[model samples]
Target chain A: MPQLALNRLRERGSTERAALDALLDDVLAGTLSTVVDGKPWVVPMLFARQGDRILLHGSTGAGALRHVAAGAPAALAVIAVDALVVGHTTFDSSANYRSAVVHGTLTPLPDRERAEALDALSERILPGRNAEVRPMTRQEQAKTLVMAMPIVDGEFLVKTRSGTASPPDEHTDAWHGVVELRTVALDPAPAPTSTAEEVPRSVLDFAGARVLA
Target chain B: MPQLALNRLRERGSTERAALDALLDDVLAGTLSTVVDGKPWVVPMLFARQGDRILLHGSTGAGALRHVAAGAPAALAVIAVDALVVGHTTFDSSANYRSAVVHGTLTPLPDRERAEALDALSERILPGRNAEVRPMTRQEQAKTLVMAMPIVDGEFLVKTRSGTASPPDEHTDAWHGVVELRTVALDPAPAPTSTAEEVPRSVLDFAGARVLA
Candidate 1:
C-alpha cells in the first residue's frame, strides 16, 4: 500500500471515489500512471466516466497504449487541488487535494461502445466540444478502442492537508511559513482576428470556476 | 519500458526538460507520478532542478514519499496547458499542450546538497517562496531524505498538438474547427492577519508583466 498523509478527510473509500468523479468532471485529462518493469510510466489522456466506469480513448494505433491493452493492470490516478499545504515538518506537510487510484485491467474498446464513449470523453472535458469538432464516422469508431474501468473497484481520497507547517521537535530556530493560495481563471484570450469575437460556452462557464492544481 | 505515445515532445529528450523548467518557473507545486507494484502512483510535490538532477524531498518520518527512499523510480511529468484540439478523428485529435516527463532513479541526496537543493526547489516555483516559509534547521534537513535524479538520462518531449481536427484520411466531410484554450492564475491572496505582508520582488515583477495562457 502507498503511504499517504492527508489532513481533511483521512480515509480512502467511497467518498474519495466520488471526489474523483467530481474532479474528473471539472477537467479534461489527467496524468495516468502505469508500471512496466518496476519503473513507473505516465501518460496524459482525455477520459470520460459513465456511472462507475472511466472511459479512456486514444489513437487507434498508439504503440504505448498497446502495452495497456495487452493484459496490463494500470493505476489511473488523478490529483487535483484547491491548495498545497507546506507544513513545517514532513508529518504536517500535506495538500488540500482530490485524488483517485484505479487499479484494474484495461482492454481497448473494440467495435462496440467506442463511438459513444469517445463522444462522452470529448464532451466531458469541453461541453459541446463534440459538435464543434469533426464527428467520427462508423469506420473510424470501429478502429478506435474506448477503454472503460469500473469506479467501484477504484480507491479514492478527497481531503485536504491544509494549515501551517508544524516544525519538528528539534527545529525552534526557524520562522514558520506558508503560501497564501488560490487559483482564479483569467479573462479569455482574444482570437488572433478581431472578427472572431464570440467565446465558446465552455470558456464562459469555466472561465472563473475553481479547479484542481 | 512503459509504453507512451512517442509523437509528443514530453516523452522524448532534454530540450523539453529545460522548457519544462522555464514553465515551472511560473508555478510551484505539481503532481508527480511514481511507480509502485508495477503500477504508476501519483503524488503532488514541490520540486526543483539543478544541473542534470531534479530534487524531490520527502519527510523522513511520514507520507508516500517514503516509497522513494525505499527505492522506487518515479517519472515526474508536468503539464501546463490543456487546449481543445480541433481535429476530425480520434487519431488526429490533439491539444495545444506543453508537458514534460523526467524519468530517473531516485537516489538519496548527499547530506551536503540538502539545504541548497531545498532552497532551490522553493525559489524555483515561487521565486521567494523559501524566504516566506520557515528555513530548514540542520536536524530537520538531516532527517529529511532528498531524492536526486539526473535530468539528462531522462528523455523529454514537448508536443504542440494544436490545430483543427479534420476526420482522418477524408478531407471532404471536414468541418472547420478551432483550438479553444484557457489558463488561470491566482488573484494574489494577501498574508494572514498575524504575518506581515510579503510582496516578493519576482512576484511583483510577474504581476507587472502580462502572462498569456
Candidate 2:
C-alpha cells in the first residue's frame, strides 16, 4: 500500500511500518474527528489496535458514534507527549511526542465478532481481565456498538520528536535541556460495592508496569 | 451566549464554565481537527489557555494550520485520563477522564498582540521562562503563526468521569476499583550545548508542580 506523505515538517515523519504500530500500541486513547453537516466534530475515545485495524466501542445511543455509523469519514489521532524541551529562546522550545493519525470510514462490527472486539478493547485497558470477570451478557452486547477502521498505509501518518532541545546556535548561560514526562498508574482503590478483598493480578501488573521506577 | 445542549450522555456533560477552564488549563496539548476539502484532518498540537481563549502556535508553512487560517471551522479536544475503572464485567468497565471540546473559527492574532500572545503560550509551558530567556527576534516572530479561539458558551462542551466504578448489581468476588493515572515530570537532562551547569528555577518549579507528591 502507498504511504501517506507528510507534507510539513518532513524531518519528523517516519516511513517505517514498525514505528506506526509501536505508537499505536503505546497509547490507549485518542480523539476521533469527523465532519457533521459541514462542521467538524470530535470527541475523545478509548481504543485498542487489533492488527491492522483499530477497534472502538461505545453505547449505541452515542451521537458521535451514530454519525460515523451513517458512513461519515473519520480520523483518529493518538499522541503521547514524552517531554518538555527548553531552548535558549521561546521559538525553539517545544514538546517531544509520538503522534499517529489514521483516516478511514468506520464499519460496525458484525454480531458474530462484537464479543471478540469488546474483549480486544478490554485487554488493551487491562490485560488478563477477561479471565478475571464474567462474560458479557447478550443484552449488554446488544447495547454496545463496536466499530473498526482499517489502518491502511496510505491513509495514516506517524510523527515523533525526541531527545534534548536543539543545540544552541550561540551558547549562553541560559539553562537548556528536556524534562521527561511520563504517565504513571498509582495504587488501586477498591470500590465500596465490591466483595473482593484482594486486588486482582491484572490491576497489580498494570500498576507495576506503569509506575515510574 | 446560549449553552450548547448535550445531545447524549447528559449526565457526563458539565454545565459549569469553571470546569471547562480548569480542564483546558491542566492539559498542555490537544488534537485540533478541521475539514480540508471536505476530508477530515487532525493533528496533535501544543496549546495553552489564555483567559477565555486557547492559544496555538505553529509554523506558517504547516498545512493543517494553513487550512484553519483559511476560515475553516476548527474543534480542539483536550482529554486527560485520570484512572482505569475496573468493573465486574467487561460491559461495565470504563475510564475516568476530564474532556473538553471547544469549537470555533481560529483567528490569527494581530501583529500588535502577537508578542503578548506568544508570551502567554510560553508562560503556560514554563511559567517563569519568559523572564529568564531573551525576547523573540523579529525574524523568529515572522515565521510563527499564533491563533486564538474564543471559548463562548454555545461553542464548547465539557465532560468528566471520576471516582470509582459503578456499583455491581450482583455481588462478585472479582476485584473492582480504579488505578489512578497521573502525568509526571521527571528529572531534567541538560543539553550538551548548554554552558550553564545548574538547572534554572523555572525548570525546577515545573518539575515540582507536576511530579507526584
In terms of DockQ, the best-performing candidate is 2
Off by over 4 Å in 2: A1-8, A211-213, B1-8, B211-213
Kindly report which residue pairs in candidate 2 clash with one another: none
Candidate 1 lDDT, B2-64, residue by residue in tens:
011223233333465557666555444445677665566676555667767777776666456
- Among all windows of 10 consecutive residues in model 2 chain A, the one with the lowest summed lDDT is A1-10
Docking class of 2: medium
Q: Give candidate 2's error at residue B122 in angstroms.
A: 0.7
Error of 2 at A96 (Å): 0.5
Over 4 Å off, model 1: A1-15, A84-96, A131-134, A162-213, B1-17, B24-31, B62-64, B87-93, B131-134, B163-183, B190-213
